[model samples]
Target: MKILVIVPAFNEEEGLVKVAEQFHGINDVDVLIINDCSKDATSEVGRKLGFNVIDLPCNLGIGGAVQTGYKYAYDNGYDIAIQVDGDGQHNPAYIKDLIKPIKEGRADLVIGSRYLKKEGFQSTFLRRVGINYFSNLIYLLQKKRITDPTSGFRACNRRVIELFSARYPNDYPEPESIVYLLRNNYKTEEVPVVMNERFGGESSINSFKSIYYMIKVTLAIVIDNMRKIGLT
Candidate 1:
């Protein structure tokens, strides 16, 4: 199967080379860096290093960046697409493990989760609380238990690629997209994976942003669920 590793980068010049180097020698898997209008030299670095990169004209947030990659994957006839964050938090070592279920045709999407085996760098205290809140919220809404609803590290098959390319949520998307898949009857599974601390660059979401993220995502999921039930 044709596999595409979509790395969404935003001001991640510090870790670009390291990220690129890790994906090297993975045969038959092409790596595409979606440079989301980074203010730094992210695009230039990718080009200078000879990596396939797509430079968005403007900042489109993580969802838009990822959707762009999906569009590329769909248009290029790729069968599987995997997202590896450019912040250097996602390890390339588990790429095969994340893609295994989808490759076997047993799953439509696979989420690389940190809570499955309780192994890896679980985030800060408040972040864990937020993750727990969303976990309970998803279970309450869909009865599906997602240990890591906010994880960006994931792999999806062609169907999901086409759907996401056509229409994907913007802004904070990790949690809401899971609801989208579940509502659409797609099989989403999670596998235990290790997360490394950010190798470079700061996270976009800080304390205030996390609060805003919680409120925004909660409302989005509610409205989406309502729409699914013809309530809106």
Candidate 2:
């Protein structure tokens, strides 16, 4: 199977080199770095690392960056595509586990969950609470247990690629994507994985931004879900 590892980057120069190198050695995996018009040298670093770099002319948020990757995967005829954060948060070792379910045809979408096995770097209380709340909301909507809905480290097959490429959320689409998959009768599962702290740079979401993000994303989830159910 042709597996493309899509790394969406934005001002992540400090970690991009290491991130690209780590995944380069993986078998049957081709790395594609989508440079989201980062102010840093993210694109140069990725190019130096010899990754298939897609440089965006302007800054697209995380969601836009990720959707660009999905589009490439679809257009390039890749059998599977995996989303890995440009930040140092996602571990590359757990990628095999994430791909297993899809290879077995047991799942079409696989997410790497930090809270699954009680292992990994614990998130801040506020972040954890927000993740859990959204996860539960997804569960309630799909009638299936989802431990992590906002995990960026995930794998999706061709079907999912086609679906997401056609219509994906613009801002913080993770939770809403779960509903999309579930409603389309696609299988989604989470794999246990560890996450590392950011090596450099501050998170884009601060305390105030976090609260605003939560409200905005929650409303998007509701509206998207309602549209899916033909209740709009």
What is the TM-score of each predicted model, taking all chains together? Answer: 0.96, 0.95
Q: Write the per-residue lDDT of candidate 1 for residues 182-209, one digit (tens) a residue.
A: 9879999999999977878777778998
- Candidates' lDDT values, in order? 0.90, 0.85
What RMSD value applies to candidate 1?
A: 1.1
**lDDT per residue, candidate 2, 1-232, as tens digits?**
8889888888888887668656756767888999989888888888887888999999888888889999999999999999988877887888889999999999999999988886867788888988899988887777888888888889999999988778888777788788878877899999899888776555667788878888998887777778777999
Q: For candidate 1, what is the lDDT?
A: 0.90
Top candidate when judged by lDDT against the true structure: 1
- CA-RMSD of model 2: 1.4
TM-score of model 1 (CA atoms): 0.96
Q: Evaluated with TM-score, which candidate comes out highest?
A: 1
